[model samples]
Target: MPTPELIPADQQLSWRAITDADLDGWEALLRRMAVEDKPDWIEQRADLEEVLAAKKNNPVLDTILGVDGEGTPRSFGRISANAGSNMVHVFGGVDPAWRRRGIGTAIHEWQVARARKRQADAGIPDGFIRAYVEESNPGHRALLESSGATVVRWFTEMTRDLAEDIPEVDLDPEFEIVAFSDDISESMRLAHNEAFQDHWGSEPRDEESWRFTVTHPEFRPDWSLAVIDKSSGEVAAYEISSYDPESKELVGFIEGYTELLGVRRAWRGRRLAPALLAEAMRRFKADGMEHAGLGVDTENPSGALGLYERMGYTPTRRSMAFEKVLS
Candidate 1:
């Protein structure tokens, strides 16, 4: 185990860079907190190997586990920045048992300091610190607001019942939807960048960062669909799906998740995306999925949230993005 760095506010409590040895204890802390805070939702296990792999891919990132004298992780935080964006993303959680103590604040303080140091090293003139909190997580929201973070954007979680028949939409004859394949990976990646480049806070993903999402343990290329421009032979849009066993096992029902859905500018208003979404839902239902879910930016210029609702998806929860400027 690595040496623990004691927090000034509480000597008994300390944090250290997490190692493979801390996986079990860290999992225990996350599971306990998830069961207590949201039993209805699945307890997603953090893959320590994958996380460590990410650190190798991006050495600037810092991941820490905070523990008490007994050596159980009471708080966790990850701080990372995107190249050229001058923005650092912060995500962390405190065990329910350790809430109301100074542990959470201390973790945030450490994250801010680490982010500043990284910015300095990179010679970034100015940067922004960003975090996301779901509406269901009131404690986190309160903490962010109290720490001078202000809401910058809102996101919605939408779900559709797979048991119901998906409406059949007549796709334009010029467009074709097909399963995602390694052959078209590069094309799809470029299309993805083109699709979201205009969106707020959008950052282009290099090959390394792009591979992390598609190669994740839960990624399901068989379920991920891509729309092709038949005439041009170019990818027009994509809906990348994944099999979330943790959520399925938690709720005792099969669920298909989509983390990314993009339609290139030229394909907008062509009914291409809606056709792909319907096809995706049908594919999920055919595979015995009970539900399909995705998160959408509420203020997306493409009118994504409205389109989702029109396609039979209902909002299950709201998540807000909070930001603080750090130079």
Candidate 2:
């Protein structure tokens, strides 16, 4: 556990482990930060509550919240590491009104310390810690750099206006696109693990995490689809989407966000990806969405960026992934 002294005394804030009681304040702070840092992605109270209730997360040990004298959350940090994985994923943010006060630095320091402790306890000798920041956020980039974390990768968020024509890509007769459902969820997870095996920073998501995603409040099963191999009866590809009401309210446009898109190695050349995307876009349009949004790794080995570009998506935002190797 990080000592109380780790919190910057100059900031006049109280730092401690987060609990259910902090949900309202934490979510409010996150919403405010998202509006300032990344308007398209906002974490709501339900999302934070789900994170706190996750079996894999130990908030008392791996999470920290810094609050002002008035008990308003100003900054917070949380870290997660799987039992056998060498990666520690860190997430948190500081209130926009409190920037440049060393509050972000303090939160980051606490996150790194907790990450190291987690790796040490797990006996991971060659692990690494990762955090992401928007390209427009120089303060966050500098903070990571000062901690010796290098920018390992870049990602771009793309949007397609539903008002434009969506191309029709025929799915090969050997495969069929099926609606996403609970019965095929586990199979799709296996297919996803296989599809992204060669992708950067890709790791097999455990059932708990996958379930959390499919059961999220914003998850739109009606908009999600899967490609099934006719002969093998296997899930060959998938496109999962969600509708963020807060984002629509903030951006003033109804957008269907594609959260995950993948095509297995064997099914790559069959145009399944484009077909799934096209079908998803049609559904989004039918449902009165004004735009389609998705994020992709700039260097995706599967040529995803090219695919999205050909599908009429334009880059709107960029983010950097930073990593620090643990000895």
Candidate 3:
């Protein structure tokens, strides 16, 4: 590929993986361009660190930067290894002031090339990559689609308001809501594997991955809740949410996510999911959050959409996933 011209900025723009030293600039750029529903730039420091750590250690993950003519980074993107499968997650951001200048398209083109190069280094297939873009984020969706990626899944970031009375959900009397903990974490992990066991392209996760995801910077153990059978203490349902100040998540957008709401197989259709979600919303409301959010697979076997809808979660954004095979 010919060298990308330096951005119009006085200094020449260069592109490269974000290092710890680049956190300041990267976060600043993210804050300036990110739209609602995306993580705030300032708060992304830790998250980006996590992404970098994964890329640095996993060998399969990669990040690219686009600098201006003056050696200033104007945009960036990353690809995370999907150890559960051969696919990778492609993500990125561009300064709002710099849009329509081909910065986004440039970064995406670089991302695909980076993914291919990583595949060569790791000796893994140059598998197609996937990305999630909010249905409302037309600019980003256009960039990815124009890059030859295809939408494969439509996901929803749902919201449930806690100020409203908690809906009466029918759950077994034996099950009780419990705070998150190591014990509950294991059960939550197991439930995720089971609930998504047959979901398209689902992959098994180890304790290591679970540890990384669950303990993310946004994790607030106290906000997480698990439902268990009183006698056996077997986890039946659970809610995972993370904290984000209005600064991180623009106002009106859910500052906290109702991250994961999982129910055991035998407990399906028993109203466990809603009841658990209601309880979580109640908790989030008490914690002073105006709203809580969660994502749902449109084709969930457990009818997750109906459950979330019943809980008063409207569709805020339809996140679409796209893929293109690279072999």
Write the residue-wise lDDT of candidate 2 on 33-131 in tens digits: 876776567776777887788777698998888889999999899998777898999988899999898888778888888888888888888888999
lDDT of 2: 0.88
Tens digit of per-residue lDDT, candidate 1, span 1-327: 112342445536676777778778877887878876674343344355556566322422487787788888888887777665688898777888778876677677777777777788888878879998778878888888888989999988888888777888898889888998888888889998999899987788778767877887778888888988999999999988887777765655687888788999987888877887888888788888899888899999778888888888998778899998775
Q: What clash count does candidate 1 reach?
A: 0
Report the candidate with higher lDDT, 1 versus 2: 2
**Alpha carbon lDDT of residue 182, candidate 1?**
89
Candidate 3: regions farther than 4 A off: 1-11, 35-43, 55-61, 69-71, 120-126, 247-256
lDDT (Cα, 0-100) at 119 in candidate 1: 82
Best candidate according to lDDT = 2
lDDT score of residue 134 within candidate 1: 76
Give the clashing residue pairs of candidate 1, or none.
none
Residue 237 displacement (Å), model 1: 0.9
Pairs clashing within candidate 2: none
Residue ranges of candidate 1 with Cα displaced over 4 Å: 1-8, 39-47, 55-61, 249-253
